[model samples]
Target: MIKVLIVDDIPETRNHLTKLLSVDSEIDVAGTAGSGEEAIRVAMELRPDVIVMDINMPGMDGVAAAEIVSQRLPTSPIIMMSVHGEAEQLRRAIAAGAREFLVKPFSADEFSTTIKRVYERELGRREQLQAITPAPSGPQEPGSAEEDHQVVAVFSPKGGAGRTTIAANLALALMSETGGRVCLVDANLQFGDVGVLLNLNPKNRSILDAIEGGEPDADLLESVVVDHSTGIRVLLAPPSPEGADLVTPTYLRKIIDLLRVTHDWVVVDLPPALTDHTLGIMDAADQIVVLSALEITTIKNVRLFLEVADQLEYDRSKLRLVINRSDTAQGIRISDVEASIRRPVDGTVVSDGRLAVLAVNRGVPFVVSHPEAALSRDITRLARTLAGEPSTSASTEKPKKGLFARR
Candidate 1:
């Protein structure tokens, strides 16, 4: 429930506001203060989630009190209320660190929503601050006996290039191939869908939880990672977009390092753009699986990404270009695409829109659910190549119904 403290000099106004908030089942009135001075005292004592302070108080006005309260407890959001809807008053409230302002005679729904918004906003700010703060040093945990663990990052320069799908399926394939020692990280902090794709709840247990306690240990990481039915361990993204800012680049590095020590393979699903956090992950990855589709726009973005990678001094050998939906009859052949991008396609996932959509809707990896499908075979081959394992003898033979066979 949202804990709220009502502050108003008028006794009747305080009771009315408290009654209004009480109607909402999600909100609880922690306490009430008669004046701004009393409000600061009560806030310091209770540290309510939200403060509804009335402006134009007798002694200390709302603006002055809000500034002091904000300084004292930066995480608690303040909602300033006034009878006059003057621009100057709004400016003063904002300058004093009030998260929201309400003119008197507002409806209960509006009041409740404003409080909730401010509270959520404050929580996000707190999480971001915690993320940037250096974690406390802890005793180093023992590393895994296996020393050949690889960190593979799946990246796309544009959205809807099927990067997450590939990352999820690849991780599942690795888990099967490696005997259940794979970890998949949803690194697209702001709007990651790895959990949804895999059908994991991702609530409370996320990458944010792993790093929120400061220094990450193997135990912490293990506790936060959720197990997928496909036998892959997953570190999910934050439950809300507001919490994305909480996972800082420094925290991510520490988490990945810890994960590498615990899991045989760590597969990260990256966001479309190149942010500082994404760049850090790419720098640490043993292989960068760059994904592209048959669309001209996506291919162009991929080419640009390759150029940027070169400028960043990334080893060309570490980059693997995969064309998703390689069998699309868009009048563009794989050879033509290779020539256009000036690079050989390392892998191709055949397009089967119906099967792909069904797999996603069922929250099952395409390879696991439809092992006989052409898309599954392609992903399996790609996984094998990434794991540095040579393909089997059967893999050498051409498929009788190859999806990418030339017409």
Candidate 2:
């Protein structure tokens, strides 16, 4: 059950809110506080799962108290309560570490839903982190940097087809299943957001520096990677936007070769525009996932990219299509998508705006925050499929049982 603390100076409001929340079986009102100071004391003492705090309490305002409570107990999610949903107050509440906002007139359903989401998000995060880090096999290659990793680059010819999201969630899924060393490289240097989405510190170390300083070995390259709470490592792009273009194809090739020797899986998120670096990454990839949407423009681009890959003698067998945002509500059907691309979409992510927005805004992966979501489930399945785990069903024209089909 989610332990909630109702923090408000007004007794009537506090009792009403507590009674409203008590109706939900999953929620438990730990206690009530009439002042911000009292709320802080309760939060520190009781360590509730969530705090429904009022904005205008005496001694300390809700925002200030939230900031203190949040610091004291970083694990608990704060939900700010306000008389009005004023834009400025809401902004302040968020900045003060409030995960969500509830207006004074919020219905029981609204309050309950927000509380449940916050609770689930936290619980899911803990589970995901636990899922990723397992015992190492033998000992890590000590001073043996070359024997450690496999770098897989994910590239597509088109943009707005969910490349970064794919790379981020795929990394999570891979790490969760394999419990091995997995690193995601945000090679889309200009607009790289893998770090931001994953809540990583944008450290100075990046692929650019490694490349510029000549082909560095695994020992030197290890300094650049940032390890997430979920155990996936990442080498972020440079903070400056203009710096991306400076990286040459030769530079990327060297980085991939080095990574392949060191990490278990090196997933790179290539930019939409095919530069020399993109081609080099594709050449080095064990698997290349081409992300496309069910749009005419994206389909046309996919066809063009396939032709280019054929001309360039890239592995057609390894190239796979992934259709993102595949909602039946959309006009574009799956048949139309396959007919245009001349290939079956490897997988489809279901429409989930709530999960997507929350994950992005909170800098957490959806698979980690809301694993039960359709998008998360599909992404996890895709990851398992890529890891050489056979699917239960096969795509043969004649029905055939896959390796793991029920017998």
Candidate 3:
């Protein structure tokens, strides 16, 4: 039940407010105060979930009482009542930390709705605060150097190729094998699935929180990146799709650069298109793990994206081609994929539909939950190769013009 405290100078007004709230079974009128001073006393003692207060009161007004309550009891949201819905009164109430403003003579519906909305928002704010894991503030490690950090970008020319799942698990595998700080970035922007795959939510706190104030810094990054129980930090994409427009390519690159300095490995999951935002991450990444499926259309797009990467002059060693669901070739073998794309497959993950689906549904990385499983072993081996084993493959092919004019 939502416990509420009603504060008003007039005895009749307080009684009427209590009566109005009494009709709702979900809300319980825990206390009633005739003045703002009494409201504070009752609020501290009762510690109600919501406080309905009059903005105008004798001796101490609602604004002053709310500011104190907000500081002392942040979880108890205050809803200010006013005689008029003027802008000035609303602004003052907000400045004093009132979560909502209600004009006088409001119906039971509006009053209850406002209280519920404010309470939900306050709960979300608390969750966001508890999720973020601040960065380490001390000096760098004894023998650490600038070249020690690695920024790996997981990309796929086609969607639904398990790019997000691979990225999330790879990050966990890296953390397990290397025992270093790993930060996973959901650069997919619009419709990112990283948070869902990891059982995390933005809760109005995402990369937008890091970039809104000004140029992002290590301190800002510390505030927005959330910590997982497995010891990996995640930078989620914006909560909504339209919020993607506010994140420019420059800001994305800046955030990537900042993360590389603080983390041993920064894994960024990219979208399927060839947009500027994707290119910015590609340019900043030290290695790009391109994911492909065992299907005809997926192989075709992979070929085209490789052509684009060649035109952009990405070094062959920088690109690692990995085929997902390789066990279900269905007359299309791995050799066909290699010959079709004219590139060797660096790694391949077997198709285990049951385990993969179960892992995703349970929001646990297979590498952590079932380390000895085939899928988990595959990802762990790949992680070790990327972390410790350097690739010897180099491209002898020449860059062809007009593959992508923009490049």
Candidate 4:
């Protein structure tokens, strides 16, 4: 039987996961822990084949524990769990050697499938390792670092344009292509929803750590990431709402630059309102995904945003306009939408309320939940297009870069 350890600060979550795994005939729950400290002790003693860890824990967080466990037990695979949308945490988790990640409130089927996949992948790696006889056992130096990493920022001047949603799904889509490292940051600092969108617990060491310059070590990043089903990693917002202001624009750039060195793609979800931090992100971004819906207010905001970008002297080529929830039923034509924005719409993502609602409610990315769905397909195409491939797609229009007055 496959042995597993469940780690979460909350008893209910641990109990629920335990009960769910209990029904599996081939799996055994070797142990469980409520804190990061206890988890380390239990994990070392149990030495289970797999660990299901929650990123948010009191005193010692899950990422910290995973770092220790991965080093001590490189043979074992860790599957991280969380509800926040901070990108730093997700990148940190993968760096710590986690094999897979499961979002919170995951269905029984998702949970089981992930567990199975993790085991299979780990087992597969071991098989491959065994085939190579008598290889030198010293530390493997420079296991292929991610290079030419591009910074993509999803920003909107107006609220409710689905910038966060686009950034989240697009990051997952990028993962599908390269299987390289991807990081999504909820730079909406003050009112970020990347965490809520993924349903990760509020306690992530993302924006707070980046702002404070705490845990600057490369290994510390893994200790804070929440893993999603699609293998996309996330760094969630602060555990508390009040902690947002602590992050400044310089810190945001520093954090993004730090990630660029390690990650193949760094996607940031910026605040609807332009702050100093937003401008910093815009200046650093290799590509700017501007999201807007087909509404009068959204169009007007896009125009104003464009004006701001012009004022800031941001490159127009880097700005890619995306129209979210584009529907003819809304009495808006693509022609009129383009006429309003003056720039050609790079891509459009059709509205699928059913799919989107289900994805957000489950704290999962729609791209993973319904990869074959219309939205998911479009997202994949968009991902390719962002990577410099072409795709004839349809959605809303938003300005690229900050085209608004500097605050």
Best-matching candidate per TM-score: 4
**TM-score to true structure, per model:** 0.60, 0.63, 0.64, 0.67
Q: Which of 1 and 3 is the better model by lDDT? A: 3
State the displacement of the C-alpha of residue 111, model 3, in Å, after optimal TM-score superposition: 37
lDDT of 3 by residue, 233-323 (tens): 8999998899898898878878988898888889999998888788878877778899998899999999999988887878888898999
Span of ten consecutive residues with least summed lDDT in model 2: 391-400
87-144, model 4: which lDDT tens digit per residue? Answer: 7878878766677766667888788778888988888866643432123221112465
Q: Tell me the deviation in Å of residue 190 in model 4.
A: 1.5
User: What would the per-residue lDDT of candidate 1 be over residues 327-402, giving only the tens digit for each residue?
Assistant: 8848878887788889899999988889889987977778777777899889988987887742121111222221
Tell me the deviation in Å of residue 165 in model 3: 0.2
Instruction: Quantify all predictions' global Cα lDDT against the true fold.
Output: 0.80, 0.75, 0.82, 0.75
Better of 3 and 4 by lDDT: 3
Scored by lDDT, the top model is: 3
* Range of the 10 consecutive residues with the lowest summed lDDT in candidate 3: 392-401
Better of 1 and 4 by lDDT: 1
Error of 3 at 102 (Å): 36
By lDDT, the better pick of 2 and 4 is 2
lDDT (Cα) of model 4: 0.75
Question: Candidate 1's error at 373, in angstroms?
Answer: 0.7
Ranking of predictions according to lDDT: 3, 1, 2, 4
